[model samples]
Target: MLDIAAELHEWVRQGRDFAVATVVAVDGSAPRGPGATLAVDTGGEAVGSVSGGCVEAAVYELCRQALRDGRTVLAPFGPTADDPFATGLTCGGSIDVLVTPVPRTSPARSLTARALAAAANGRPTALARPLPSADTPEDPRPLLVHPDGAHEGTLGGPPELDRWAAHEAAALLAAGRTGTVPGCPSTGRPALFVESSAAPPRLIVFGAVDVASALVGLGAFLGYRVTVCDARPVFATPARFPAAHEVVVDWPHRYLERTEVDARTVLCVLTHDPKFDVPLLQLALRLPVAYIGAMGSRTTHEDRIRRLRETGVTEHQLKRLRSPIGLDLGARTPQETALSIAAEIVAVLRGGAGPPLTGGRTPIHHDAPGRVRRPELRPPGTARTSPRNR
Candidate 1:
């Protein structure tokens, strides 16, 4: 899986034979979504998780079998008795897993190798394989689709079918999701499973405070490429924030104005000073970043709003800023405050309300769109570099 690409890539480079079991489909409340993979080498070494801890042992055995037989299999696990020996998910959901062998000499091996390499290098890629359904014919080969309209492997289907699948996979790659798409009707396939490996989302914290250190650590743990920026060099040192991918010593506003950001980027303003917060909030609110939060009390937030309005920030743009920064978790320590902030950021990105999930009507997993809509910030006829270009 892309999550463990570094380890898997090393295994492939060492000429080790392995088998990968991927969840291609899910029904009801599955613990893991589609594209969760569990890989096992011939020597029984394993990495990654397919179904949390519910069916790992069963899946591992399936991988070992696939490696020995050099055959691909589709195994379904659910609450029913479909699979006599198959482990059932306790969460009352059903999932269909595809177990495939990746021997060094197989065509699938080359495709897997290419995908792992791309993921290791932080390149966006999609791996599309045919699901083994009753109505679908056998398709052992998988295709690797890249962002530049390039692809590897062949489905042995019509050229049109391949093009259609590539387009579908590309869309998923852009959205940073892994799921199944309807197969080509003309090709008589039931469905295709697209596993997307996109670059990690970015979290840019614009203060070198104690909270920033905790935030950078938690952001990295959540698979974000974090950057800590501040005008003060004494506080923004690498020794203070070692978890950050980059510690930038510059004005927060100026750094953000020149740095690249996309729809998935989160900008956190921890600099409570009016001199730093006002200008930074001015530029960040107008940008297309997914989240923009600033730390301050309610009274301070009101004052910051007046300053921002004085600087010509529009009312609509002002709504974009999440002042007071985090959810009301009664947090006092820097670590607990960091957790509250991270929780709010995730709630915004996942379209969740910061409330108890105990008896809520909200879906556990929000269905994200096919592609993240880019913000239209530039004026008409003004050309700006696209986020995907970065």
Candidate 2:
């Protein structure tokens, strides 16, 4: 799946046949959500995970079986009435997993390689696969949806059903969200389990400072499409920010105004200068972005707040700013500082507190509404990303 695209992409290039198991549904307390993948090559080498650790062995065997038989399968992993110790989730939740084979000769192999390549490189793409069932059609089965209303493959359904499913996947891609929606309408659409994999979210850094480079790298590692913007063309060059997906020389506020953003966008104003920070933060604090953090000392923050207020920024909007960005980890180096800031971004994303978990009674995990969860991430910066997104 796209989560392990870097490795899976290589598997395709080498013409190695493989089977993939994807978590398609969840009932309760499932550690991994829909779209979580566990891929196994013909050689029995595996990458990625479907569950935290509960049902991996069973899922692994299922993938191996799929590779051998070349049959798409949908299996459930949960507590069984006769055997409580069977392959199931220990977290008291149930999940439905779909195992699909990607043989070298199958058209799906090529289609999957394309989706993986696009998603790995931060291009806006989503892969939608219908669960295998009695009415399941033959090969070239999955539907590939792009952000610009373009689609590649088909669900082998009626034209109307394919169009409708592609539309739904496109909407999910626009939001940078992946999950199960109503699948192909195969004769009343029998509630087919659909699983979608979308590109990563956005993390826009509004400064070309030394720390910006580290932040860009970390953001990509955490699965964000990173951008660096500044008004000075001299500072905002690709040579300076090789980690950034794109480097813009336009004014921070001006560039933001013309760009696309959503609820998942993270804005980091690293340009402490009032000329850059004030106007940018004023606009950012009011947008529907996920986090708005500005870099400045306490004195500079107070001055910046005063300037923002003078620009008609209301108290409600000002309350959203996270100045003096990053957690209080006594960080000094740019890498440490970037880690602290990235930690805070994740905290905000997951509704988590900045306190230590040493001896707290607070729930260890907080789930933000509609927040998409996945297994461990494969750092995007370390991979050979396609140049298309750049």
Candidate 3:
């Protein structure tokens, strides 16, 4: 939802008003999960989407009414047994969406502001909002939580209920998944929707040549903070690597020594030379970086593995390396090869097996680059296009 957030920030800065529609709950066979958000502005223009395409026109009308009447609503739209919209969902599932108006200045706006700021700083966050009662149909609770476990709203139940929801919020932030926990009649799960907003992963390229340049550019497009490091001064200049957030002219191992490498970081050795790539691979294998890739051929990879094993990199660590460094897309050029590698990184992030697209039954999470948007099209000059935030 970073796109939505950036759009909202710009709109707020320009003194415009908008409302957000979020899918807060889903039942059997639902398309999108809880926390899918679509924001509609005063003009009716929107960014982000909640559903596939069934109820957007209905939602836009609701957003216009809410803006006009100054009311926020918990709305449900679905196909009845007799309604043509009954084909609303491809999977024939129903969803409950929470449509809340963001006042010029209110708790909701403040919470969104805080979330945008935290995300800009690369901090993880979660937005926790209570589900409207399936029985009562009137009550709703909204909560926002930071990575440190601090919370802003209550779920309108017991103290224990709020505490349990808070713990769930923190856990969701760490896992980077959006879901809900039902409020059991006795156990008190607190029926809440938690949306995880974490910083993008880090992609570090340990080369400064043409292939490294392509990899850096592709990595940035894929939402990674790209860093290019090399010991050579002439090749590692900022002009050659303008898209990279940082260019470090230092020995690869020396630079990695002072850096923080974790499961959220990816290291790619594109030097291809045995002397440069071997030492860096040896050092990178010791860290917890989620993906370690080296650009080389099968023969080169075999030779590199032999050297790594001799240099004390365990077999377990060697398995973590994507030596040929990409999916077998049979990519030939540097740009195509970079695309293959970046696609692999995305597959790793979402825990996908990177299997062939043919007959793939499992749905791909985050269908679009950003979040959801209002499905209907408004007449010109009726609505403004705003971005989405995760």
Candidate 4:
């Protein structure tokens, strides 16, 4: 339900009761994964989606039922013979959904409100809801866990159980993921659905041009806090890139040096000019950003690399730069070019090769390895004072 946090927050503020259906598990080719939510308020209003479109109607009805009865219900939908006519996914997948009523007076409502508020303010927040298990009665009270290891509400299990669940949820929150974890020892089943809503990743676009404007829109749509920076004040205006979260009139390198970027950040240098590109490329290559692509032709790329190498950038660092920016999509317009760049960014993040998936041997989804310790959890540009800092 954290996906529709803003709407849920407003609903709670207005004392409006609602029901939420969250996907707790999936099998086969389910369109939506765990943590996908479909919420319906008392007024028959809805926000968010649990399935791509297949089982929304059925989930909506389940939500309404939960709202009317003020009871939590676990509804399983699949292509199986059981309740086939009631709800079946055409994608040949199965999903278990937990529909819970969120009355204004319930502790769940208050916990959800706090989680939503934290997410709205760009804070790392997680919501842990106890799913029903055969061994023990499910705890209806959801726990709101923050990055600092503090939590509100409780699972009503042993204190150690809550701590264990909170620790696991914190690990998932650090990775900006949402999914289920094994239940606490008392529950004896995988009963906790940890939904993490980390702050949006950063997208810093250097050089405010037509392509930059298109990229800003695409980046924002992809849930990035996009910033368009350029030294030329006339070119870098909020009017040109209305979708960007911020537009800065500053040198790209200087701005990047001072900005709060993390390993999840994506830097796109579109300035093409050596004065702006070289210094920025040097700094970006050394950082641990997820993507660093510079827009230029092959000749310009070679020239930029030569300059970067001259300025003490190592061969290993230069390899991280993706110059001649995007995939070869034969894009001729600014919007199409932006799409190509966005596609490349997504490909990099998901460890996908920018190639046709048809009849390909590559797995559609890459299984990410175990989480690695991050240098710091604080926002970029903040000092890494933690003892764990590398």
- Top lDDT: which candidate number? 1
RMSD of each: 9.6, 8.6, 7.6, 9.5
Candidate 2 colliding pairs: none
After best superposition, candidate 4 residue 318: deviation in angstroms? 3.1
Candidate 4 lDDT: 0.81
TM-score each candidate.
0.85, 0.77, 0.78, 0.83
Clashes of each: 0, 0, 18, 1
TM-score (C-alpha, index-matched) for candidate 1: 0.85
Q: Output the TM-score of candidate 3.
A: 0.78
lDDT of 2 by residue, 1-390 (tens): 776778888888898999988887666567887778999998999999999787898889988988888888777776443355566776666677878899997877778889888867767688877665455664338888888767887777678777777777777777766666643333544233334455557899999998999999999899788999999999999999888899999999999999998888999999999988888887888799899999989999999999999999999999899989999999999999999999999898878888998988665556566744332122345321111111
Clashing pairs in 4: 260-380
Q: lDDT for every model?
A: 0.82, 0.79, 0.71, 0.81
Candidate 1 structure quality by residue, lDDT tens digits, 1-390: 665788889999999999888887776677887778899999999999988998888889889998888877777776634444546776667677788888888867878898999998888999888776454445367889997657878776667767877887888887677887865445565477888898888899999999999999999999999999999998989999989999999999999999999888999999999999999998999898899999989999999999999999999999999889998899999999999999999888877778887889766765453422212222366432211111
For candidate 1, give the lDDT of residue 373: 25
Better of 3 and 4 by TM-score: 4
Instruction: Sort all candidates by lDDT, best to worst.
Output: 1, 4, 2, 3
